[model samples]
Target: MVKINKMLKSLHISNYALIDTVDITFDNGFNIITGETGAGKSIMLGALSLILGERADIKAVRDSGKKSIIEATFEIDDYPTLKEYCLANDIEWDDTMCILRREVAPAGRSRAFINDSPVTLDLLSHVAMQLVDIHSQHQNQLLTSPEFQLRVIDSMAGNDTLLSDYRKRYAAFRSAVKRLHEAKRKIEQNRSDEDFTRFQLEQLDAMNLVADEQEQLEHEREILSNMTDIKSTINGALDALLNGNSNALSLLSEAGDYCEALGRILENADSLAERLQSARIEIQDIADTLSAFDSDLNADPAELDAIEERLNDIYALQHKHHVSTVGQLIELRESFRARLDELENSSFTIEELEKEARRAKSLAKELAAQLSKRRAEEAARFEADLRERAMPLGMKNLQIKVELTPTELSSTGADSIRFLFAFNKNQPLMPVGGTASGGEISRLMLSIKAIIADKMQLPSIIFDEVDTGVSGDVANRMGAMMQSIAANIQVMAITHLPQVAAKGNAHFKVYKQDDEHSTHTRIRRLSTDERIDELAVMLSGSTVDNAARANAKSLLNIK
Candidate 1:
C-alpha cells in the first residue's frame, strides 16, 4: 500500500510522438496550463497513464524512434508486495520506494517501475490505483446506478455489517407483507355476492325456529290434522251426559233421587244427598268446558286437507335446506341469523388498513432518525475538511455542505446527500451542476478533492479544461485553486485559461508540423524564451502583438 503524500513531482518523456523529449517537474499540488487549440496539451496526462500500465501505442512513438519513456517520482512508502511485483516484472523500484514509472516502445511492449524497481502494468495499476483515482465524465452519468446508490446508502448508514442484516430482513418482511395483502385481496375478489348472501340468510332466518321448535310445531300440526274425528267423538260423549238414558249425568240424577228417599228413612241420608249434588255440579262444569272445545273444532275435510298440505310444505322446505329435521333447520337459522345481525354493525376494511399504515410509518420514522444521526456526524466532518482545504485556494468563501432532510423510507433509505457548493461569499450554495457555472465546478471539484483526498489517496487527479465555461477573474481563481490542490496531490489539467497556464511549474507545447511522408505531431519542453513566447502568443494571439506580449510579461511577473 504505497501512499502518495506528494503529487507527481516531475516527468521525463522521450520519443513519445510529438513529445520527443521533455523534462518537467510538477508542483506538489494543482498545475494548470493554457495553450492554442490543437496543442499537444493531452501529452502530459497521457504519459502518466502509460506509466501506470495502459496499452502501448506503436504510433505514439516518434517516427524515427524505437522506444518511449515516461518517468515520475512520487512521495510514497515502500510497499513490500509492490516491491516484489516490480522485481518480478523487470521494472525498477528505487530507494524512495514511493516513485512509479513506466516505459513503452514502438514494438507494442510496455514496462512499469515503482521506486526505480521493475513491475508489471497490472502490478503498477493495482498499486497506483489505490494512490490515485480518475473519476472521468462517463462514469458520472451512472450516479443513479443501484450499485452506486447502495454504496452511498452504506456510507451514510455507517454499518456495512448491519446493512446486510437489514437487506435480508427487509426482503423477508416485504415478501410476507405482500403475500398477506394479496391473499386478502383474493379473498375479497372472489367473495360471495351481496344479493346471494342476503337471500340465503333471509331464507334460513325466516324459520324463526329454535333447535326444538320444529319438533313441537310438527306435533301440534299432527293434533290439528285430527280435528274433525276428535270433535265428533267428543260431541257424542257430551250428548250422552246431557240427554241420553244411559248418560252418566242422568244415571247420577236417578241415583240421587233414590238416595233422597233413603235419606228420609235414615238420619245420615241428607248428608249423602248433599254430597251427591256437589259432585254433580263439578261434573257439569267439566262437561261445559268439553262442549266449548267441541263447538270450536272444525269438522270440514277441506280444512283438514289444507292443514296436511301445509305440513308437507314445511317438510319440503326442510329437505331443500339440507336439514335432517326441523330442529337442524332451526339450529342453522339461529347461528346464521346471529352472524347477520352483527354484520349490520360491521365497519369498513379501510379502518384496519389505516391502522396498519400508521404502524409502519412509526417504525420507519424510528429507523430514519437513527440513520440521520450517524449521517450528521459524517456530514459535519466532511464539510469542515472541505472548508479547511479551500482556504489555501483563496476560497475563504467556499462552503461545502451536505443537506439531509427527513424523507420517507424509500429503497434508498431516508437520506440523500448531494454535493453542494458556494464559490462566492454569501452566495447560496447550489448543487454541483447548478447555475454555479464551469469555473465554479472546477473549484468545487478541487474542494471535493480537499474533502475526499484522504479517502481517495491516489497519485493523480486530472482536470481537462475543467474551467471551460469561465474566464477572467473566476478562471484565475480556478487556476490558483487547482495549483494549491496539486501541492499535495497530482493535478494534471489541460486548460485554455491563461491564468491556469501560467501556474504550471513545468510547461509543454504541442503543435503539428509536416515531414516528407506525413505531418507529424511535435511536443517539446519550453525554454525560458519559448515559454514567454508561448504565454505571449496566448495573451496576444499568434502575431505576438506588442501590447499583448507586454501584458503577458506582466502576468508572468505577478508574485
Candidate 2:
C-alpha cells in the first residue's frame, strides 16, 4: 500500500452564509459529501473557497453583528517544501500541521492568516493551492483553453525540467535582444544630437581648463590689482634703510666702531661689537631684496585683463556644467568622451549582442524541439490511455486524438495542441469541445484528472459534482477512479449520485433545518446504517421501499 502522507484534517466554518457553525473532520481516504439540491453543499464549498483566499461578499456573513471565520487544518508532513515555504516566508508552522484561516467582518473587511501569523491573500492562495485542488464541474470548459491543454500535455510528458531550461534560454535571448535594441536606440539618439555634443567639446577644449588653474589665476589677479600700493611700500622701506643718511644701518655701523674702540679698555666690549656688526649685515640684505621687488612691480593692465578673461571662462564652464569646481568639469568632460566613444563603436556592440541573442534563440529552439518530440511521443500514450479509460465509462466508440501542430516558439514550446474527439462510429473527428456532449465531456475530464492525480503528488483533490451526467456502471467507475486516486492522496467529492456516494470510505450528509428565527445548514458524518438509509432515500426519492433498500444494500455490499 502507498503510504498516505498528506490530507486535509478538518474544516471549521462559522457565521458564513446560512451556516452558523459547521465543523467537519476528514480522514485520509475517499470522503464523500452528499445532499439534496439547495441543501447548502455549495455553501460549504464557498466557505472552503474563502479559506483558500477566494473573495467573499458581505452577504456571506450570516449575521450582521459578528464576523465570519473559516479555518482549515492540514496534515502536511509529506510536503516538505511547503514547510520550507513557511520557514522562508517567516510563518510559524509545524511539521505535522498547517492551518489556514480567513475572516470577514461585518464592516466589509477581511483578513487571512497562516498559522496565526497575519498574511496576505496572495500568499494564502499560493499555500492553499499546494494543499488542495478543487476540481469543479465548471472546469470542463477548460477543454477549449489552449494554455490549459498544453499544460495537460506537458504534465503527462513530464516536461518540467526541459520546460524550465527552455524558458531560461528564452529569457536570456529576450534580454540580449533588449540590449541590442537599446544600443541601436542610443546610437540613433546620439547621432541626432551629435552637433551639440561636438560644439560642447570644442568649447571645453578652447578654454584649456587645467586642474587648480582657477586658484592660480585668482592669485595673479589679486597681485596685479594691488601692484601700485605694493611698489610704493617697498620703495619707502628701501629709502629708509639706505637712501637716507640717518638710516638704522648707518647708525649701527657708527655704534659698532665705537664699541670696537672701547673693547680694548672694557671686558664685554668685543662681544657687543660682534652683535652690532651682524645686525648691520642683515639690514643691508633686506634693503637689496626690497629694491629688486620694486623694480619688478610693473602694473601691466593687459596681463590683468588676460587673467580676468581666463578666470571668467573657467567660471562660465563651471556654470554650464552645473559644477562647483574645475575638477568636476574635468570629470564631466571624461564622461562626454566616453559617450562619444560608445556612439562611435555602437555598431560593434550591437553586432555582439545580436550574435548572443541569436545563439540563445537557437539553443531555445533546439530545446523546444526536444520538448515537442517528447510531447508527441506522450500524446500517443495519452490517446491510448484516454480511449481505454473512456471506453469503460460508456465511451466505447470514443475516438480520442491528441493533435500537435507546429507553431512559433513559446514558453511552453513550439506546439499547438488540440484534443479531437468523435463519439459516433461513422462520424468524423472534431474538436473535443464541440463534438462531445456535456455528459461525455464530464467523464473525459474525470479520466484526464485521474491520470493527472496519479502523475502529480498533490495533497488532496475535491471534485464538486464532476460526475454530473453519469449513472450505473459509469458512476461506479468514476467512484473507483476516485478511490484509486485516494490510495495516494485524499479525495473528496461533493456529490448527489447514490452510486458515487456508496463508494466512499467515509460519508457526510449536508442538509438544511428551519429553526424559529432562520434556516441553517448543517453537516454530519453518516453512520453505516445512516448511509444505507440515505442511499436508499436517494434511490427512491425520500420514500424508501424494500427494493431500494435491497439495491442500496447491494451497492454497499451489506450482508
Candidate 3:
C-alpha cells in the first residue's frame, strides 16, 4: 500500500460553537473517531466546514464578543495542479504545505485566507474542493438525483475532456441559434418600416443637401432682405470720398497748382505738390468704384423670390427632421439609407446564420454521440464493480443496473442516467432512492467512494457516520473497505460501532465535560489501553467488562 503525499495534516478551531479551542492532528491513513451522540462530533464537522468555505453564521460563535476562527493545514507538494491553480489565481503558494483559514467576526462579517493571503470565499472553496471530500449522511439523498448519477458514470469513464469539448460545441450551437433568431426578428421588424425609410432617403437625396449650406443660405437671405439700406449706405460713403466733396479731385487739383507756383519761391512746396497729386488719384479711383456699385445695385424681385424659395425648402426639411443644421439632416438621411440597405440584404444574412447554426449543431451532435458511447461502455463496468464491492456489506442479493436514456443535447451530454437497484431475486429493479433502505444507501455510497478514490486521486475524504445502520460482520466489512481505500488516500470515519472503530491506525474519542459556568466539548487521541476501554464501553453500553475487552482486543487483532 502506497501512502498519499497530499493529505490534510492538522486542523485548528477556536471560539466556535461548543468548542473554545481544539487542535487535531490527523494520521495519513485510516483514522477513526468514536463518540456518543451530541458529543461535539457534528460540531467538529461544522468547524471543518468553515475551512471548506461554508457560510459563517454569527450564531456559531461561542462568545458573542470574540471572533470564531477555523484553519486547516494540508501537505500539497505532490499536487502540482493545485499549485498551478493557486499561482494562476494570484494566491501565495507554499512548496510543501497549504493552509486554509476562515474568520468570522462578531459583527457577522466573514473572511477567508489561503496561506495567510486574503481570498474570496469562492476561491477558497475552489481550492478546498481539490483538497478534501467530506461525505455526510445527508448526501445519501443524492442517490435520487440524475445529475449526480451521470457525474459518477462520467468520472468512471474518464470523460472530462470529451465532456468539456461537447459542452463547448453545445454552447456554440446555442449562440448560433440565438443570433439567427435575432436576425430574423430584426428583418421582420425592419420590413414593416421599409417603405417609410426608403421614402425619407429619396426625399433627402433629391434635396442634394451639402454641409454648411444652411449657414451660407441664411447669410445670403439677410443681404437680399436689406438690399435698399445697404445700397444707400454705399452711395453715401462714395459721395463723401469723391462724387460730392466740392468734388475732392477738383479741390486737390487746385492745391497742386498753387504748390507748383510756390516751388519757385520755396523748396518744401514742391514735395507738397506731389502729395496733393497722389491724393487726387486716390479720390478718382474711389469715384470709379462707387459708379460700378451704383450700376450693379438694382434689386431684382425675380432673383429674390428664387432665393427665398430655396431657403424655405431648407427650413422645411430641417423642421421635418427635427434638425437645426444641414449636417444633422445629412446624417439622418444616411442612417435611413443604411437601414434600407440592411432590409434589402436580410435574406443573405439569415442564410449565413442558418449555415453556421447547422454546422455547430452537427459538431455538437457528433461530440455528444461520442460521450454517450463512452458512458455506455463504462456504465457496465461501474455496475459490476459496485456489485462486487457492496456484496460483502450484507448486500449479496444486490442487483444493480445503469439506465441511460437518450436526451436532447445539453451542457452535460445527450443522456439521462439512473441507478436501478433490487435487493432480492425475482424483485423488479427500481431507482436506488426508491428501492434501497437508509443502511443500504450508506453501504452503497461507501462502496462507490472506495471504488472511485484511486481514480480521483482525492487527498482526503471524511465520512461522517456513513456507517449509520450496520453491525456485526457487515460493519467489520465496511471498515475493511475503508482500510482498503486508505491505502491510496487519507480516510477519516466518525463511527459508533466498535467493529468499525477497531480497524483504525489511529483513534480519537469525542466527549463532553462541564465546568461551573458551561459545558465544553473536547476530543483527544486515545492510547492503546484507552482504545480498549473506549471500545469496551461502546460494546457494553458505558460499562466495561472483561468479555467486552476481550472482544475489542480480538477485533483489534491483539494477542
RMSD of each: 24.7, 5.6, 6.3
In order of appearance, the predictions have TM-scores of 0.45, 0.80, 0.74
Give lDDT tens digits, candidate 3, residues 349-464: 99999999999999999999999999999999999999999998998899999999999888998898889999988989999877888878888988987888777666588988
- Give candidate 3's TM-score: 0.74
Worst 10 residues of 3 by lDDT: 239-248
Per-candidate count of clashing residue pairs (backbone under 3 Å): 29, 0, 0
| Candidate 3: C-alpha lDDT | 0.89
Candidate lDDT scores, in order, read 0.63, 0.87, 0.89
Q: Which prediction has more favorable TM-score, 1 or 2?
A: 2
Query: For model 2, how does the per-residue alpha-carbon lDDT over 409-503 read when each residue is reduced to its tens digit?
Result: 77777899888899999998999777887778877877887788766666588999988877788888988988788887899998878888888
User: In model 2, which range of ten residues has the least summed lDDT?
Assistant: 450-459
Candidate 2: residue pairs that collide = none
Q: How accurate is candidate 2 locally (lDDT)?
A: 0.87
In terms of lDDT, the poorest run of 10 residues in model 1 is: 137-146
